[model samples]
Target: MQVWLDSLLALLSLPQYGLTTLFVVAFVSATLLPMGSEPALFGLLKLNPEMFWPAVLVATAGNTLGGALSWWMGYGAHKMADKYAHSSHHLRALAWLERMGPKACLLSWLPLVGDPLCAVAGWLRLSFWPCVLYMAIGKFGRYVVMTVALLYIWPDS
Candidate 1:
């Protein structure tokens, strides 16, 4: 497993593959999958500090697109969610989401709940463009802050 991981990392670290690898990882991590893109971002930046901005931008774009995909998924799953609509917990959560509207997508950068929040917004049929805009803004901020913090903490690397 360690050898395979090292080989994969080596392939991704190549000059031609670095940004693309980061984008793919960031996109997938934004889904319901239990993975984090931070390590990939940090590793790429550590190896090529000059590519920081590009990496962040690519990651942000990929993550935002992934969030959008989740939104569509939620939109399509609305019927399935309907069965639980009358539950107390579901009602309260729905009320909160309805009150917040598309603005709730700003919280889409949060861990665990972030990606699902996008899906909920879609399930509730909130305005798509606005949610996407908020998602992009939040995700961009997260990538920038996280990457900067990580770089600061491991400057020698």
Candidate 2:
């Protein structure tokens, strides 16, 4: 198992499969998963400084797509969620979501609540394209800001 893990790590190292690995990491991280993709992005940038823009764009795209997937998942589970909709917390959240509409998706870049926010948008039946657009914009900004900040903090890396 150790040997296999080592081989997998070698295969996914930044030198040979940087962008693909970053995309996968970013996508999975944007889901309900507890992982973070910043380390992967920073590692790739540290290894290949020339790939800054490409890495950020790829990461943004992957994360946005993952959010869209979460939206669909929530859409499919609408009935299940409805069963618990009578709670006060659920009512308040649902009211806020309805009031904010697709604009709330701009916060999709936030930690902890971001991914689930996308799902809730779908559950509320918000406009799909608009939500995706907001998500993309927010995610793109996050990637650019985070990557630049990481680079600035570790310039020598």
TM values, all candidates: 0.92, 0.90
Candidate 1 lDDT tens digits, 10-76? 8888758999999999999988888888888999988888999999999999999999999999999
* lDDT against true structure, model 2: 0.89
List per-prediction Cα lDDT, in the order shown: 0.91, 0.89
List of clashing residue pairs for candidate 1: none
lDDT, candidate 1, equals 0.91
Displacement of the residue 80 alpha carbon in candidate 1, Å: 0.3
TM-score of 2: 0.90
Instruction: Give the C-alpha miss distance for residue 80 in model 2, angstroms.
Output: 0.3
Number of clashes recorded per candidate? 0, 0
